[model samples]
Target chain A: MNRLDDDDDRPLSPEEMLRLIEEQQATTVRRLGGDPLLTHTPWGITWLAGFGALYLNYAYDLLSRSTALAVLFALMVLSMATTFFAQRTVSSQVRGEAADRGMMYGLSWMFGFACVVAICVRLSPLLPSEETGLLWSVTSMAIVSALYAAGGALWRVRTMFFLGAWLAALNVAGAIAGPTVHALLISVGAGGVFTAVGVVQWMRRRGGA
Target chain B: MTGPRELDPVIHAQARLRVVATLNTLGEANQITFPGLRELLGMTAGNLSVHLGKLEEAGYVEIVKTHRGRTPTTYVALTRQGRRAFEDYTATIRELLDLG
Candidate 1:
């Protein structure tokens, strides 16, 4: 550890002082958060494998509906757990208004999804099995897309904003294509997008972009 | 036009300057733990404490000692006055450099 000296009288050119200020600010911003890849990759994998299982189960009858749903549920749980732990690890080290904002943002996701689940539960019993599945998947995707877009806008992350827009469009397209095709579209389209975004973020970090 | 603008002495010191700059990165209502700030700045605890004292005296920083569970912790935040002073200091530096 460097001892702080009474460098108050130390002469620095204006350029040097400006550079020092910039450097300190940059370092603090970088150090305050966990890597984005930690959150993105787990979610990507969960959606890919979970939705892929659903597609196979629905299209080819390769798996039972119960088994497919179980796989999706388990993967979703795991992804949520990973995200929670990653956030907790980072938030524990920092405190303040930004942390509170982050906490509220995370809670919004839970609150939003709980509402989606409740709505789906009430509506599912009235529809046919296929429509019920479509309703649940579509509504969930819509909520997720909306949250992502909002979060992206809040944080000024362009890629996240665009990804959310893309997901919203993809969800609509899948719904239009009908039920079985909806699962297939989400399995390939949404899953692929998530994985691709995760990979791009990871590469950017590795390349120090 | 006139003689060069003077930077705030309270924020112009190298160590305190770095501290203020880092704290400024946080949101207006945010704070950093003493250990967190020290580790970020790579300063000795004694050195940081001394500098923080000086900044606190100048009303540039607010240091709050509180407990989290059974553990005691100190949090350091930049007061609004400190932020304004930093902004003024930067403006003066930029003017001196003729960077507008």
Candidate 2:
């Protein structure tokens, strides 16, 4: 028997006792809804750096391929080192769902990259080399923007949703503006938005702390 | 009123109720660390440990201990059984309230 009913001699009516329990449950549920784990801190600078590297690789076509590859390798090393340290410092319990979501997010990006590569290769046979890069850029941007937008909808995060919308708009604007302008728009416009979001989140976290 | 009769006594205890309630809020995809759970429930380490032990013994929750660099961390997740029990408990509680 529940402890609530253990008191046979209790003067309170059943309705009154039930009301109290309901009220308590409501309070508990409300408190639970406020759990901090729901909001994730966006590592804006990391993403900005990543996008900047890509833009640089495309914008400076005269740069040696080896140099571009070396820059990418350096960026990869930096990202890995930062992640290794972050895991040790961050103190959250990752559940299976969060882990699964992360895995899916990574897979989506990889798949998007692969699709862009395959499309570029196919288009190269039909189009001039000069047009191929621009086509690839626009398609890749659209894919990433759509993926982010889809993720935002699934996660119900307003910031993520807005970022996705912004990226899509940038991609459209880039298409009309030409290759150099498109690269700059992605590297600065979209990248700036992500960085700003991260900065604001960092400031809020510091303030709260 | 006979509250929904399926309430698991192991889960109905006041402190454990809060713990389970909090975990349930995360929607099965996330676990809670020992410190996170303790702070959320406002319980001391010893008290929380005892309640967690009971839940673990009942096979309702799975506890994992891992090392993050030099520090040892403990994570707790509700097992499928535990989730079902929690659901049943809430349904019963709702039934009891509605009986009025």
Candidate 3:
């Protein structure tokens, strides 16, 4: 602990301020590290399941197939909470000023952008009815995921960038990948990729230690 | 004729100052949690609980509790009175600093 950690001492450096901010962004994820998404990898993709499950509901509801939208919504919230948990866990484990204040939150912005797209698609009837709700939901997830990856990349978390890029690629590949495959890619491929990344990162972290 | 000034910890001390600044990062414009305040301040649980208790006593902060599943999360916020006190404190501090 330097003078910066000294409570009774003088002010902190600008670098110190940035470090504090970084740790806070990842607080919850760290506090709740058991989340599936927070796996040992930087790009664990299991988080995409929330969107994949949501997509199934959209497909079902299309035949005017009404099920438990509320339940699904609840699950979505749970998934987000878990994701935040994983993020916070990772942040907490991060040492030094650089790790504490990594640029992870920007990923949520991508989600915001995706949400906007989902809303637009929902209102416009551009996508198939069955795909409508899921479309909106997944689009939003994609946006957020992409941004988070971007943030991870910015923070030099190569795994984060790898995961984010994979999602952006998924969106591009969606047309060819189609819905069922797209969903699987996100849920399985993407998720597996992320988990792998987390594992590898963790290994490296351990090896370094 | 005006009265005597106020006392607000959210506006003072290195610790409370860090707490509010960190909360601002959440951007919800809503409340913060006890664990969150503790994390933001990077203080031990008991130490933070003590500072928060003092702030609450001074009418500078308020705490609300809720549960997510079995875990109880405590939400904290600056009261209107607390915010006013903090604002007043900031102004006085600025004035004092300016005098220096």
Name the top lDDT candidate. 1
Best by DockQ: 1
Compare candidates 2 and 3 on DockQ and give the better one.
2
Chain A: TM-score in each model: 0.85, 0.60, 0.54
The runs of at least 3 residues in candidate 1 whose Cα sits more than 4 Å from the true structure, single-residue gaps closed, are: A1-16, A30-34, A202-209, B1-3, B13-15, B39-47
Summarize candidate 2's per-residue lDDT along A83-187 as a digit string, tens digits.
445533333445467556755765787798899889888887798654665687688778878877877786666666778899899889988977667767876
Positional deviation of residue B39's Cα in model 3 after best superposition, in angstroms: 12
Query: Per-residue lDDT of B1-100 in model 1, one digit per residue for the tens?
Result: 2327767877777888999999888869988788889888988888889889989999999999999898998989999999998998888888888853
In terms of TM-score, how similar is model 1 to the real structure?
0.83
Query: Of the candidates numbered 1 and 2, which has the greater DockQ value?
Result: 1
- The full ranking of all candidates by lDDT, starting with the best, is 1, 2, 3
Clashing pairs in 2: none
Off by over 4 Å in 3: A1-75, A85-118, A121-127, A203-209, B1-100
Give, for candidate 2 chain B, the lowest lDDT window spanning 10 residues: B1-10
List the global CA lDDT of all models. 0.82, 0.64, 0.53
Q: What tens-digit string does per-residue lDDT give for candidate 3 at B10-99?
A: 444555545544444333335656765675466877766766776788776777877756987787776677656544655655454454
True contacts kept of each: 0.80, 0.27, 0.03
